[model samples]
Target chain A: MSKIIEIKKLRKVYGDGVELVALDDVDLTIEEGEVLSIVGPSGSGKSTLLNMIGLLDTPSNGEIWLKGQNISKASSKERARLRNKELGFIFQYHHLLPEFSAVENVMMPLLIAGVEKKEARHRAITLLEEVGLGDQLNNKPNQLSGGQNQRVAVARALAGHPSIVIGDEPTGNLDSKSSDMIYELLRKLNREMNQTFILVTHDMDMAEKTDRILRLVDGKIVCEMLRDGDKFVTRDLCKLDK
Target chain B: MLELFVAMKHIRTRKRQTVLAVGAVGLAVAIIIVFRSLMNGSFETFFDIFFELAPHVLVLPKEGEEYIYLYKTLIEFIWAIPGVAAVSPALSTTATLSFEDNVENVDMTGVVPAELNKVTSIGDKYMIEGDLYAIQSGRRVALGDKMIEKLEVQMGEDVVASFPDANTMNLVVAGVFRTGVEEWDQAAFVSLETAQEFLGDGDVITYINIQIEDPYQADEVAAEISALGYDAESWRTMFPQFEESLAFETFSNNLILVLVLLIASFGIANVMNMLVLEKTREVGMLMAMGTNQSQIRRIFLIESGILGLAGGIFGTAFGYLVSAYFNSLQYTVNAPTAPQPIVIKFLVDPFDLIAFSLLALILSMIAGVYPAHKASKLDPVVALRG
Candidate 1:
């Protein structure tokens, strides 16, 4: 498969007064239609790498590419536009706007992409159907359960039909049964719709099940593994003992 | 437009706060409108007194430092002017009257009994206790209301009137008259011939009261009379000091208008600032959705503008209602110079409403500028972080 996202010699530092390196000399290439996982302990720089690829944060040096576009040098607005059209992001907290309904939250990415209201609604409904929560579309985040709201957030991240999805512990707030369901859904979409997945998680058995896994420790890639089928947030929710 | 609806929804949701802000604006507008109206109404009402109760033009003695017993030439000259309504000649002098040692100083005016009807109707209304024809017959004289009260005398009571020439003559109380003024109500009206004889002017009159077609033409008539070498004065000229008082009231009213607008501007600014603060995250969300800075600014400007415009319209109506309420208060006042009602009447101009509304909207728009700029400057990444 051809590489769809490339990160070359990327480094991210925090603080102006005292330097803290969140990502250090990281180089990565994610192929088209690939399902990849970056797994590590709590402070192992996996989430920071995910942020750099998602364009939610810029690397201090080096270049990152998304599809055919060089996105490392994109302006803040350009980054927003790219995120709206070419990528989908799901975070552990479900980050659905508390003021909006589940469907409206799902429609957000399409709206951000400048899709017309009706068209955005239609696509949001379709994505919600894909996530198996079509009946819950009108409910707000507060009105819905944990697993339900996370599914809605997942539906939102997929609404614009982006080629790639990046999830940072997307099911961290969910029960084991819900985590299994979410992992199954992501795998199904990855295989059927040819969507690429780059997820950061602490799930060891789940990482061993993915098509590729890069393990990190103390701001460095310590190991890598290649496998198939599924990966879930935190391997403790996995079927490893089964 | 959609954004405005959303903002309005937020405002409506916070009913108490919105009402307080709107009430502030409404109260300011109402007070301003009523003040301007009452000032205008009183000003108009005050001028009407001169036209209705006093002469529009007066032709007086033209000679230097001499009393005018007769200004026949000036009276005839003014009577021929195009807008002249009627002219009556008059002579007046002060004399003391006594009924058994009760002496009252009386102002005696000599006027043609028939022509004087056009100026006032005191002679027609009063009764003569001696005889109906006594005043015209020159056999008896009239007594004032206050004089009767002081002298404790009935009509037909024998009275002695003494003039400046040491002439004390016996007469009967012919009648009593009232002219709605304390001073005029006390004055005695005798036939011009009788008064001329009493003052010893010998058929010459002192001044002429020339009624003009319109009260506004009083100044022009007075100027024409002046050109003819007569010292002509209009009612307005007679009340220069009164007019000066009214002018001061107008200045104070304008000062109050400034104070209200300044305070109302602060209210509008505060509301707009709150709106901008509340919508910060929403604005950031919109910016991340690829909306430009101008679109974000337009949303806020349009939002505050709607608030301002609605406030202005309601405030103007509120002002009108307050003025109308003032108009309803019609108790009469008895001022020493010119009596009036205890209440103020409402009067307004459409121009005043339009000007005040525009001023309010401009203030609201000015208040929106900084907040709008702040919203537009938000960066998407930092905004979307949470």
Candidate 2:
């Protein structure tokens, strides 16, 4: 399978004098159709890494290659175009605009891509139905439950039919039942469309379900786990000795 | 298209704020339109009175001379001027009129009645008693109503008129006229032959009044007439004080308009700033969804544009209705120069309407810029953290 994304020597430093390294000397690659999870504790740079890969932020010193282009040196306009055409993002909080209906929210990415309104609407409706929100298409984010809103976000993330989707603790705000349902839905969509997903989460069980996992500790990948059928084989390198 | 849709949605979601911003602009536009219309109406009325009561151009002798010596030749020369509609020769002097025990000082104008009537509308419409031809025969005089009353003399009675050169004559009061102007009503008119005879000057006249084909072209005609070795004055040059006052009125009116529009623009700016602050999270979400900074700026600009358009339309309609209502009222203004109170009517100029509305629109759009810039420059990561 072709590599969908590659990162080399990624380093992100915050503040000038008393510098804090968010991601230090990181190297990573995501293959096509890979379901991957990045697990880390608070302040461990999981979100920072995902942000760099999603083209939402620039690394201080690194090169990020998305599909074949070096996006780290890309212009703002070029970055935005790549982000819109090739990548989708889901935050910990469902960021569906409260003023828009479910279908309207789902159609946002396609609309941003300059698709015709009528066609965007038709595609958005199909995506929403796939996410089991067919009957709630006209409901606004405020009117829907938290779990339902997250599902709407999922549908929105896929509206542009991007090659890769990035999620930052997408199910962190939901209950166990809702989290499980979201996980099942994401897996079903991933297998059906062969779209790669990079999820950042603290939930170990959710991390174990993915095809591969990378454990981050203090801005460095300490351990990696690969799934074999129904089991996860762990390779531990560093311990949190505080 | 998406930018417009999002912009409209933002405005629709914040109904109260949008209405208040729009109302501020509307009120400013309406006030400016009403004030300007009234000022224009007053100026127009004042000029209308001048055009009706006086000649468009007047020709006088060269400096240090009291009369045009070759008066008949000058009159014929002026009559042949291209734009000259009519020319009437007149001799004016301060004189005293006495009838029995009553005597009053009056300004007397001597004119050829037939020629004067063609040059001015003062004769036909303002005649209260006798005809304009009554003064053409013999040593007859046509007195204004106020002058007749002051002298306590009846029509057809004789009055002793004495000129500054100690020349006196007994003139019959043939008619009484009222021009609805106090200054004009206090004057008396007689034939040019009688005036020259009374003043003991042979065939000499003080000035010649010329009416032109187009009143607005008075300056060019006056310049042409002045080239003929005479001092020619257009109505504007004749009334410098009135022109100064008119200019000052226009300047103050425009100043008020700018001040009002400035205040309204601040109101719009304040509303948009608040909206930007309130929607910071949504802005972040949009940016994260791949909306460029220019697109975000366009959205806010479109919002302000919509507000301005709505306000301009509403204010124009409201102003027209209010001006119409004012015109329908029976209010009158009393002035010292006018014999009767003049009725007030608001004169709305289409140019003023278009100008004020366009100014308001531009101001509102300018007000949107700062807030739109702030919104566009917001960092998506920091905004999402909020």
Candidate 3:
């Protein structure tokens, strides 16, 4: 119902002598409590867009507003603070610290935000149980299966109770069954907690499960699809010329 | 606190690397401690032998004067100085002693037995045969034990002594002493009256020996006495070579310690760098979780500091054990110039040990800085992509 994030004229260019444009003049908006996905080919800048929203990378040119605050040019420390307090991220590889157990991995963001250890641990356990990882609390990432590790990563992302959760191909490394399970879990969490989620993926089936889908090609959104009664219907052709 | 927890976990999980790094640092510290203790022990033993054999300060006659004519007043004046423990005036000359079959050159000194006993340890510590006080009553001599062997004479035997342009005298050997030091053992002592008669000088002495409460305060005490227009010298000034050698030994020992510690610190740096490289992805995840660059740097520093502390403790314990073992053995060492061998007991000062441990910690921290900085500066996106 309300705009949670807005990006205008976003651009990311890499290299010194010969520049390669990763994202070009991208304009997008995310609504609160919405489950949405960005679907595109492999080199279409979907992950780059996810990284920008997650505050994991600096943009060369952009105006990004998160809950009415402009954070496009925030200092690195401030960016980290915003990322910890307002955003949660799940990467394709799970990216859990190998030295920590599942519960500890879930508790990291809470601890980083200066939460007490006991409280963080309790909340992390609750989140892990919610993600059906109750029995794997003390298991390290290497000791767990691909699906179970992704579940642990999901629990970790939700541990901070962030306003927005961002996933960059979170299920890309898992099998189809594990991928569907992850999608179901994300859908359930979005409904129960009323938290917004933005996923980047190439799986058309996974994209169809979200409330809305944005199709990207050559760093530009060409169309958007809205879910209507168990199916997605294209709203309009919003293609940008090169 | 979380940073520390993470650091500790990192160290714990890498068992082999941690042990190797810690072992390198520990071995370096142990080597430093052992060598430092041995050098300190040897110096202590050397100074003990030197101070016992010589006076803290000696007052000689003015230039061109053969003897101190006003020796009595000079002795009284030296005795009045603060920290002066005892003062004795003595006359000494090189003379030859001849028995029936053997003859040898000896340094002859004359002293008042009571005063000499107070200024030197000869009467109390070195006497092996008849009493030095026996010389006070008659024209008797206390000869060194080695001289007794060389001259083929026994205690209570009469020997003929002669000096340049002085009448030869017949003296009976009354006491035998052994100091374990060649220079002191080959000397002889007699009554002051006998020396005055033999040297044909009336109530005069060659030098006044002054013992002090602290041997290290010799320079200050000697300076005060020298200000009174006498040729005064401390034992340190008299033996410049010994001082130089002691200084050189300390310098070389410390140089070795620095080099070893530097090498050990490089090993720490190398290990830490490898850890940083290996944990690049985890570092990116931490950054994504809101850990600042400074916090990232602190995590690595704390890890290295813990390693250094662990190593220092282990090394100090190992060094103490080894030193104690050697000290218990009471190994004998031969000083090149001395005729006797000394029993060496390793002594490690507690303050020196603490300082060396702290030095190890500081050096390891310095070595960790580069790697920590590199870890902190990593790009989260690129690192995560790895």
Please report the TM-score between candidate 1 and the true structure: 0.63
- Compared with the true structure, what per-residue lDDT tens digits does model 1 show for residues B177-269? 544567765777667777766766475877888776676688988998788677889877887776688789888888889688768867767
Model 1 DockQ vs. reference: 0.17
In model 1 chain B, where is the ten-residue run with the lowest total lDDT?
B125-134
For candidate 3, report its TM-score. 0.87
Residue pair clashes in candidate 2: none
Model 3 over residues B113-229: C-alpha lDDT tens digits?
877887777788789999988998768999999899999999878999998876689999999998877777889999988888888868889998888887778898889878878
Chain B, candidate 3: TM-score: 0.83
- Cα-based lDDT at residue B79, candidate 3: 74
* Candidates in order: C-alpha RMSD to true structure: 8.1, 3.9, 3.8
For candidate 1, the lDDT comes to: 0.72
If ranked by lDDT, best first, what sequence of candidates would result? Answer: 3, 2, 1
- Candidate 3 lDDT tens digits, A1-242: 89999999999998899988889999999999999999888888888888899998878998889998999999999998998999888989999999999999999999899999999999999999999989989999999999999999999999999989999998999999999999999999998999999999878889888999998887888889888999778765755342
Q: Which digits, one per residue and each the tens of the lDDT, describe model 2 over residues A1-242?
A: 99989999999999989999999999988899999999988999998899888887899998999888888988767877887898888888999988899999999888888999999999999999999999999999999999999999999999999999988998999999999999998899899999999999989889889999998987898878888899887766545352
Residue pairs whose backbone atoms clash in candidate 3: none
**What tens-digit string does per-residue lDDT give for candidate 2 at B10-31?**
8888899989988998888888
RMSD of 3: 3.8
- Model 2 docking grade: medium
